[model samples]
Target: MTMTVRDLRPDVRADAEGFSDTRRLALPYMLSTPESVVHTLTHAHPDAHFGQLIAEEEGEIVGTAQISVAHDSPEPGQGSANIYVRPDRTRRGAGSLLLRTAEERLAALGVRKLFAWVLDEPDNRAFAERRGFRASRSAYFLRLDLAAGMLPPRQDPPAGVELRTGADFADDPRPMFELDAVTSSDEPSDIAVEFTDYEAWLEETWQHPLLNLGLTSVAVVDGRPAAFSAAYTDGGTRYATAMTGTAREFRGRGLAKLAKNDSLHRARAAGYTEAFTGNDTGNGPMIAINKWFGYEVCATEVRYVRELG
Candidate 1:
């Protein structure tokens, strides 16, 4: 069997479908679609130098990698390379070939520190350790069966607060962007990211193919967005929370929970049966809120770092 790694052709429908299928099979807890795969490649910031590679054996895609520099981060020389091989097609040298290609590409882009997420399995950890990558932080992929799970009863916002949907901000989404920027800066991660470019956010986030504006819920205080839960759907039975956060000044009031709960109820009503979300283990408050919503830790992944010369 001939194994080769090459850059994905965004215009090719087969390439996108193959890439998305491999990712869905390898990481079922996360959502992926052909349209999303194309959107990510075309809408990424130019400075990010984003590229996606696919490892093909004969005519079938066996592995895929998404590589990019942390252009929005204040820290330079930081990059990410997430590689995944079809579970049924591993051990055929696809993973190693894809990693080698990813590393070479990232190194040429001036990456000094590379980061990757490995599933918390013995074999996966061993593979990273063998490649000189050391584990740093861990995160959990939580799942809730919306079909049978009992969501908290809907509640009325406080006297000065009101519940709104992302669709309500269509005429002017600058407020949602502002709230997202403030909350994203506080998220726990090895790399600190700043969302300074509103246009970039609009292209890369707000306008993404999976973003479900009608299902997303926001908490508005005095006509300003204070907290929000961004929802994404596969347009099928699966739904996910892209992000749920509250403005700094509005913390400690359970606004985040309120927004997320409202979003979940809307998702269930829209016929989404499964809900998935991820959280860093260090984020105690968000973890507590997910647990309160009856979400269970379905899987865990550890972030690994490797220094490049």
Candidate 2:
């Protein structure tokens, strides 16, 4: 059977569903939904020049490529193209075809630095190396058996602080946004990012299909959101933390730990069975927090970079 790479069409129902389905199975730790897929296709920053591509085999979608530029970063020509094939559908020509097509699109946009994330398996690493990419930093996927593990008991906030759900700020989420901006910039990563557009945040993150406002816990200090653990669910037993961070001024206060514990407790109480999150290897403090919650490292992936000539 011949494999071919092609653009993913948002208007086609089956194609969108297949793309989302493939991603969900290949990268279970990351939350992906049909609605969120469409939201990403339409609302992504214009400067990013994002492309959603799929690799098809004998009429079945087997792999996907999410290619985009790091438009908001201070550096120019920074591009990212992450490829994921369905676990049971490897060894086909899909991965190569997807990479080639993505590189061509990125080259046309004058991309100079191309980055990709490949699973830390031997074959995946070899594939990336053979294609002129070198490994950089790596991160682990942590999972907690919410249904069976004994989560640490939730703690009361110190004076001048309180625990609250993300839903509490339904009328005004700008405070949460401000906290997110501060935390995101400080996250350990290869590419530096800045999030200043409120409207973009509303379209991309706030309106995402899996963001569970009821379960996302936030720490409030002096009536201002200072730390938070964002939640995403597939309307089932699986729950994941999209992000957890503390504002710069409040780093030493332990508000992030408080929010994450509260969120995990809520998820387990709400009948969730599994909880997933990713942590960069260099982030000792965040890794320790996940360890405290009994999350074991299930998988790891390395970021590879290629400088386009």
Candidate 3:
């Protein structure tokens, strides 16, 4: 049976649902919903040229790929193609076909380097290696049972510190943006990124369908956002902390921990039963912080990179 690869249609609800289902089954730790999938498709930056692909066999969607350039990076011509096939449907030609199509699309766009994330399992790792991708950084996916887990006792912010939700800055989110810029710069990654475009950030991050401003906790110091725990939800019960960080000057004050803890508390109160987050394996402090909140490492993925001539 021949497998076919084609672009995903955001307007098609079935396509979005199938894409989301395949992603969730292939990567149980990451949060992917139909709405989030569509949001990404609609709001992708022009430079990124983001595209989603689905592999079909016998009219069934079995594999998916999210292809895009690293437009935010200062370096040009770098792209990423993250492909995943339904666990039960692997060993079929769907995965290979999807990846080939994605690579072709990216290469045509002048992409000189390609990156991918492969599960830290033998078959997944071998697949990437066979395709010329070399292992890079590794990250862990963590899960917390919000309903049953016991979080660290909430602590009062020290003097001059205040807690606010992301919604508080709805009228003027510049401070939050600045804080995000500073914190994101410190993130561990292969591609260095700078969040310099405020308008783009508003459209891509702040107004994203999955971002729950009401539950995203921010730590304020001297009337400015000093730390934040960005929250994302499925509009159902699952909650994920998309990013949690403190400004460089605010480090050691536990502001990030405070913000994340508050967000987790709010998430549980709102009936979100499961919480998820990811951290680079080298991010020891963050791993320790999540462990403090009863989060357990559920899965691991290794980043792989390939040079395209």
Per-residue lDDT over 217-298 for candidate 2, one digit per residue giving the tens place of the 0 to 100 score: 9999888888999999988788999999998888888889999999999999999999999999999999999999999999
Model 1 gets an lDDT of: 0.96
130-223, model 1: which lDDT tens digit per residue?
Answer: 9999999999999999999999999888789899999999989999999999999999999999999999999999999999999999999999
Candidate 3 colliding pairs? none
The residue ranges of model 1 lying beyond 4 angstroms of the native Cα positions read: none
Q: Number of clashing pairs, model 2?
A: 0
Model 2 stretches with alpha carbons more than 4 Å out: none
Q: What value does the lDDT take at residue 250 in candidate 1?
A: 95
lDDT of 2 at 84: 97
Assess each prediction's global lDDT (C-alpha) against the native. Answer: 0.96, 0.92, 0.93
Candidate No. with top TM-score: 1
Q: Tell me the deviation in Å of residue 226 in model 3.
A: 0.1
Q: What is the per-residue lDDT of model 3 for residues 1-309, given as tens digits with 9 covering 90 to 100?
A: 778999999999999999999999999887889988998988888888999999999889999999999988989989999999999999998878988898899999999999999999999999999999999999999999999999887889889999999999999989989989988988999888889999889888888988999999999999989999999998789999999999998899899999999999999999999999999999999999999999999999999999987
